[model samples]
Target: MARKTSLKDIANKVGVSTSLVSYVLNNKDKENRVGKETADKIRKAAKELNYFPNLNARSLKTNISHTIGLIVADISNPFFSSLARTIEDEAYARNYTVIFGSSDENNDKFIKVLDFLSTRQVDGFIVASPEESRETVLGLKESNVPLVLIDRYFSDIVVNTVMVDNFKASFEATNHLLNKGHKRIGAIVYESTLLHYQDRCNGYLEAMKQAGIVDGTQFLAKVNHQSLQTEIQEAVQKLIFEDKVTAIYFSTNTIATEGLKQIKNVGKKIQEEIDVVAFDENLIFQFLDVHVPFVSQPIKKMGQEAVRILIDQIENKDQGIINVLLKATLETKEKLQKVN
Candidate 1:
């Protein structure tokens, strides 16, 4: 086997700039920047010479590491894991590599990770949690770094973002339980710096208010992220035994799973004594003898669009503060068997 032909080969054969050849081949010539005749000539030369993008060589020439830095709140959480997987695949498809890390929702830890990845000269960043790193993000923006925020973002700063409508999704999910005649519902969520969680908590509050439930905000249980495992179980117990909530809404999968464990420990059956609703669904949840209605986000689409925007920012310097809000669906389990 022979070494594959490179972009430079095609550029040399077509008498065009290597930059022009790259833009055309990467489909980044969105504004028809390259004339049709010139694009055709480049393509013809590439095909004739069997030229392929030498990503490594191009990285050296363009001063791009061909790598992206992905910082999530916590990779152990299923949502972040799934999001990272999708982003990694999408970045690789665009001829880029991804270096991922978990921030554990700590601003200091997040800053360290960003510093490490930045030193590697990664071309861009796709951040899932920027709630605590607002200043750091602003610095990166000022430095002309390409960035795309997912999951959560800062409202004060203008940044490219891809997020689900958390307020609307949480409102609909809570209303789903309320519509089922569960007037007094409890919500278990970690109290964090993420703006999305605040929106979710408010959504639940709004639903309770709409149902004419008095002191509706009282049912919202916000726990510390560091002490969530203990705090969540205590909160669940309080809602069930003391407050006598007829239903519970978990704002994230971490809360949902822990809430379920608490419910089971207290010997309660879902949809019998109380109903349950959560933000994200997992395969293991399906096997549980419980009816769990969940809000499903378009994770893959979010990842693809974020990567596309970041690449655009890198190639064309087009960082015009794009805010893409995607819709989430409320999936209800209509059929659930009762456990004896």
Candidate 2:
């Protein structure tokens, strides 16, 4: 293999000292009082020599790996996949790299990934923590590790977090269904201890209460992550047949997809037999016979804020804790005709 080009090679070609080349390549020329013309020549020579800095050596000297670890619940899920892409773009724009993993909503796997990323010497972490990972989050905080929780977080933990106002999002979705004459509406959600899920459930309950429904909990169904499809089908059956609900609210996109499938299996059509609203938008909803309305979270903004806050924590140890709750909008094709 050909030898790797080095800064020394660029320096020799430019007839400059290695330190001057380092200053220009590292973007420290202005601070070091190097002339702009000389800096430009150094940059030109470095490009011509195809010189790539040794990141490992630089990291060892500066104590910054310039890499972040991102852990989400499920990478295949469209919401998370989109969020990850946005984060990657934002991080790249800021000259940082992201290494991401999926926890599969398992606390043990979440901890393992955390440990693995920590060993890789990541500068910071952005995580959508799994249920029952309170101690793990606390441990990271206590260790002074730079972390920013995204999409999900523990309410009791005092740490940096960037997430949507799930409660409001759910409440608006539930209220939208109610406005369309869906009094006996039901909701399907994961049976997780994560505060984001709880907030969503609470939002639905509160909206039902405000609509004069005495006990909305009776219409609520919780499904486990381990048996998602099966549980969602069962929940949809019970809500439609037993509870006699005229509409359903799905808390997550995965739940919405499975519930819609179950609805089709039972020979029910959206907005015809039953109205429906989902928390996160999905492209599939648009192609259906009748488009489904959904709560649209600002995914790009959430990812950008998470990276910004985590990088801030990594670079500024004295920065105060930050908690950001972004708003979500209810998106629909058109106002639905009132149910008879």
Best by TM-score: 2
lDDT of 2 by residue, 201-298 (tens): 99999999999997999999999988998999889999999999999999998899889999999999877898899999777886788888889999
After superposing candidate 2, which stretches have Cα over 4 Å from the reference?
1-62
lDDT of 1 by residue, 1-340 (tens): 3556677888889998889988787666656578888988987886577454333333344576678989998888878888999999998899999998888877667766776676566788898764467766665555567888888888887889999999999999998887776777899876777788888988888888888985787888889877878998899899999999988999988788888888888899877787899999876597887668899999998999999998888777745778899999998858534323
TM-score of each: 0.78, 0.81
Model 1 lDDT vs. the true structure?
0.81
Q: Which residue runs of candidate 1 sit more than 4 Å off their true CA positions? A: 1-62, 335-340
User: Model 1 — TM-score against the truth?
Assistant: 0.78
Whole-model Cα lDDT of every candidate shown, in order = 0.81, 0.87
